[model samples]
Target: MPVESSALPPADTVSVAGLIDNIRGRDHRQSRLAWEIYTDIERIHALTLDRPPELDTRVFDHFANSSALLGAVNHIDKSHADALVNEALALVHRIPLTGLCLYDGIINQRQFQLLVSVTDLVDGWPSAPDVDKQIAKDLQDNGPGSTRRLRDLTKRAIFAHDPDAVRRRAEQARARRTATVRPRPDGMAHLGITAPAEDAQLAMAAVEALIAAAICPHDPRKKNARRSDAAMNTLQGIPLVCQCGREDCTATPRGAGMSDLHARIVVHVICQDGTLGGDSHDGGGPDEGGPQDSPDGGPGSEDPGGDGSDDGPGDDGPSDDGPHNSGPECGGDAERPGFLDGYGVITADHVRAIAQRPDAIIRPLNPKPGQALPTHQPGDPYRFSAALDTFIRARDGYCVFAGCNKPAWACDLDHVDEFNHDDPAAGGQTSAGGANAKCRYHHLIKTFGEWLDDQFVDADGRTRVTVTSPDGVTIEGRGHTNEMLFPALRTVRFQKPPPRGPTTPAADDPNNGSGPRRTRTRTADKHARRRRERELNRRFRELHDFGPPPDDRR
Candidate 1:
């Protein structure tokens, strides 16, 4: 209103010198806007459910059909919008936590989904309400962590509340296990199997074991190529140490006795000399290692990079969760705790526990590349030798497609230049470095479909694949390195968690980390709740110890 106000600069540049660090009122305004959005969503859900019970199936059908119409008008995909509407209805009817989180306006949609997914894990617990509240608080405590960390916290909560439930869930999951195959475009099909967590983890470990013994540093194959070769051999029922260390299990060695399972699975364990004594390390939860450079690079210190391992269910696999061989580390120990997975990150301790199994196969992973791969038949340059096969398999840890982490060991090895039998000159060189690790379906796509791909290897031997789609779009993918994530595992140990510091936006999106700011009110409420719980438990224990008023007869 003032004349001077009209002459002011744009808001972003108008801050006073000392005011740059201050919080703006607009931050709180965002929270208010979120609250309004939640309210509107709730209203839409109510309108659907409030339909007369007498309308029965017709009303239900309307709820489903009308959502598509609404989504269409809004230019949102119908199925996804319908799903959102249904989820909102469920929140109002089933979970009250959403309302609480919405009221605070600090929890964004992703956080909400994470909270809901974890809370649902407690569904069968005897004390669902208490578990829900506890889980909700734990989610809030972290503010917004990585999606992986959030999932790990959910695991921590589950185990802390009910170990028995975990055991039961694992058993139930195994009973529901299955291995299925689905066809993809072209002649390719997806192969997926779900077994016990221990079995699954051990099976994956065996492949890595083979790759380590065969792959060499100068070998041309990428990480994915090596993995693909290893996986195929493993699937052929190679004499792997089956049973995952479970002594009493009647489960026979997979592919055993039959020619199918006769492939020899030899394990080799090699590690540098090291002494174990002092506790100078700690572990992060299942998904993270500490961010700092370890002063001593202690036994448990993170090794920086390792490829991922398949440890859970996929699109059509069995129950994902199971009783682990190892328990989760307490809190945020940074002594490089956690195991590296197929995705090259370590956060779960069960990986080690699985490795500890008596029947688990162990093998050496030479950091420097091993012997030169073989090229059989001096007269012919087309037959890839076993050593060359191993080289390529080890180089590629999984499929070479961008973001498609299907274990390379279980994929197909195809020649990049397309092998030729009729014309010797036209035939591609049969060498480990010239191979690619591609999944069955993806391979078919490259071979017969309108897809064209080319590869280039860096001087350091990391291979890159550029894929051109039927459309004009082109995307590039780089293969994993040959580094091991846990090289000092023989003496590794869990240490204390790293210190907490500032919170940062987890993702690059602007929508992230814009939730309501923390205040003294949160801390005070947390402390008060602790006091109340202690008082309640104390009173209950006192009552329990009284033994029914001493029994008048006694």
Candidate 2:
């Protein structure tokens, strides 16, 4: 299907395309208005070029740093204001055809940004001089798809033009890999790492591997929480413990400070009947619908009193002493890709590598609710009970505040309505429906910044939350729903499990990571089930089921 006209945000909605949609709200009028702003932007760009040569400022620097100037004029934030000026500088100076199209609001700012990035991507290639024309021509002919699709096209074209440039860049990028820390408001900090493309992909693969290997479907850790933990485990060499007997898992060392940082990081992976879809069960095929055919054996299949064993194939689940992926036979799916929470999808090889972890552990959690229970729990006071917290975490996925990606595990679970301590009749009861996970930062924002958050169950059975800023801007998002724990793995067929080779980590698995690769020689899952069963048995024997001993401790 084509990119519909309305699929993209209106030019003025996020761009400098001003008030054009105000008149009739017709498609043509919106386009005209977008083009009007685009043309004005071009005019400004041209005017900037004619500035006296005596002035030292380059047109590029002037445009790039003109966010304040643009913001002052457009009445938007500095970031959005920069979009207007940068769009003009990018399109008019490089690809005029794209500039013209934007002038008429043919696409949104995101599409324009995609084109800009593609142009920059090919700029250093051997065919750099002519690459712009070729790129514009391709967009003119093929029509842009998603940003990723556009990036792929750009890379392919550049690679075809000069494959050596691609090789050279790949090698050169290795030297650029480094980690940095950026501090945020309210004592929060962001850690950024840039690795070579392969390592970067594998790193994300590790995160997905950790999530899949460590987190069960019923655990309340939102994807962001899982992702944060996964990244920490991968880079920090942390060891994940299996809490099989536990029903809920929270990020550990809650109040630990910098001084308490240890050489070993601990990860907690929870598994339940719903988290590990036992291989090739009666689910018919991967795509087969209905809870009766759930990938992880549906809601009620969980063992309330077991170590996630006897749930069938993955009973052993994950173990710290388990063998790794990338050996003679890739641990699981070597071709299928799993999702990297908060980022994108990862390759099967990456998935396998994570599963092969010597520090990975798996445990079982109680079954998740298949549908909404009563809005509030009876007789519960203070915060949510463990059951209600688990239910809410599985549903919301992350902090309820807007644009905040803090994981639910790291957040303070709060009631939407104030919990009544003084008057039970006047105060809201602690229940799944009224509970939300908000990090301390966002919690403050909601309490003092006049931000509001409301949650409701959507038609698809997903619990959706609407967050409104003090300025009254509201946006909606959803979290973990009644979907399978591993949707990508469930929907996409993996390779047929190969004959077991070594019961140890691959000497050179892209590092303890893994997936189920499919084959036609036999039912893809037949091998998958057998392989999982074998892994579970081997690892389960070594599991303390209680806990592991530390270097200096009992």
Candidate 3:
């Protein structure tokens, strides 16, 4: 179909529009290539430096801006661009030089302002999987305060200054969050001690002592077992009493201590027995052989007592019998009968309630009250004493970690090696031999994480501890050693390097300074200037299109 000449725009106008479209396309392609090159730079840099390939968006931005200078070189010859990149790489090879360059690259006046805005609003850049990339994209598209904002002003400022500083700040924030505190309505309040995170641990020795004290008074083997049981039950607010007594003696009320101790003892005893039956269940009874006969031909009967025969004392006299019958049972009515039918029976279920309460104090039933303490067996006393001494020294009268001040005496001694049935390598003799102490929280970490591998062997053959932080720092002794145990306690300062000068081309060089190098620089500067002009024009056009300025001509 032939188009009318009047309907179409002028040829010159069409050509201009085409030229504009071509320029836009070229701009888009160049921008895309620049971004790709930036990504490549980052990947190569991270790999070469042995750092994590994924960097914070803020770090990426820093590198991107620095590489923008390279974009300027793109306008010149390829050889010049290559030289600039090579120079940059060479500088980066020196560790301190790289740090300084990255710092300079990220912290110019414009970058500083942007970093502050981002950090102030966003809280901080996230370090999770793919998060930094997302954050960078959002910052570019929507600017600060957007949904994808990554950091607050403070964090941004810190990051722009030094990435390590930002990292340290983040770690401190996390530690503050996890630090121990009193329970509050909103959550744990960041007050009180900051001991290692842990569950409350109980000492077996303390538990045993408590249990013994509680139950010793009511022990059936005691002098006045019935009276003591009644007294204990009264103290403990329980109904437990000696059924051996007819009075149903309810004098002493049971305290938490008495009830708990009794229950624990009962359970312990029953567990020892396997079946719930008491010591009586283990047989110590007479043999199955019939009773021995008397030498006097007195009633030769199966029963220990004679069957109405009077070969010596007219059926009532004692008879001379074999060794088995020598004990008075050979004569009439000399055998003692089994326990009476009406004796009381103690059941395991009766004590179940008291056994499970955490606050309840347990006691042993048979320990001698007010009696001299038993001498601890040789190896046993030394082991326990050594462990206790180590705990006291390492903890230094309080929790070793910063901000935690829990008294060492109040803390429980935790075994570094958990006593578990699974993982035979961690069980029995091997684990027992490897035991080291920690408070409840550190114990949990060791049992549940990589802290199990963190150990220290002391001069006395006792193993201490080592803690590896998330940042790959290894802290030893829990502050027991001379060195600063926490990164927070240490200070890091950086010194800026001197500025670089322009490079001079050698006379022998094939390409003169005006060759590829000069061309690249000139082209880059031209592109930058063009971009600036375009941006300014766009802004001005928008302003003019929106409204005319107010007339101030008086």
TM-score winner among the candidates?
A: 1
Number of clashes recorded per candidate: 54, 32, 35
Off by over 4 Å in 3: 1-383, 386-395, 400-403, 414-437, 452-465, 469-473, 476-478, 481-554
**For residues 300-329, could you state the per-residue lDDT of candidate 3 as single tens digits?**
122232211101111111111221100001
Off by over 4 Å in 2: 1-32, 48-52, 55-69, 76-83, 103-106, 121-129, 160-172, 184-188, 234-238, 242-554
Q: Write the per-residue lDDT of candidate 1 for residues 1-554, one digit (tens) a residue.
A: 55786586668774453242233334434544554554566686556564454455464465665576568767888676775665454455434554355445434565555655655645545755555555556434323333543454444455556545544664666689999989999997777889754455556555655554444344455676666656765667564333234445343333223322212322111111111111222321121211111122121112221111111111211111111111112333332323222333222233344345454432222111222223333344444433333333334445666546655445666665554443434323454445666766777776666455555554333455656565534543333322122223212222221233455443445555787544435433443443354345445444653211111110
Which residue runs does candidate 1 get wrong by more than 4 Å?
1-38, 54-66, 76-79, 90-95, 102-106, 122-126, 156-172, 237-554
Per-residue C-alpha lDDT of model 2 across residues 1-554, encoded as one tens digit per residue: 89998898776666222333333246535544665666677676566554454465554555644566667777889778777776666665655656554444444556667766656645434476455555555554333433443454455455435545555554566567788999999998899988633345435545555555555665556777767766776556665443334646543322212212221122212122221233322222111111011123222232221111011211121111111111011122223332222222223333334434543332212222122222223342443333334334433334566445554444556665444344333333455555566666766665556555565544434454556554544443333321222322212111121233343432553433555432322422333343344345335433633121112211
Q: What is the C-alpha RMSD of each candidate to the true structure, in Å?
A: 23.9, 23.0, 38.2
How far does residue 105 in candidate 3 sit from its true spot (Å)?
Answer: 24
RMSD of 3: 38.2
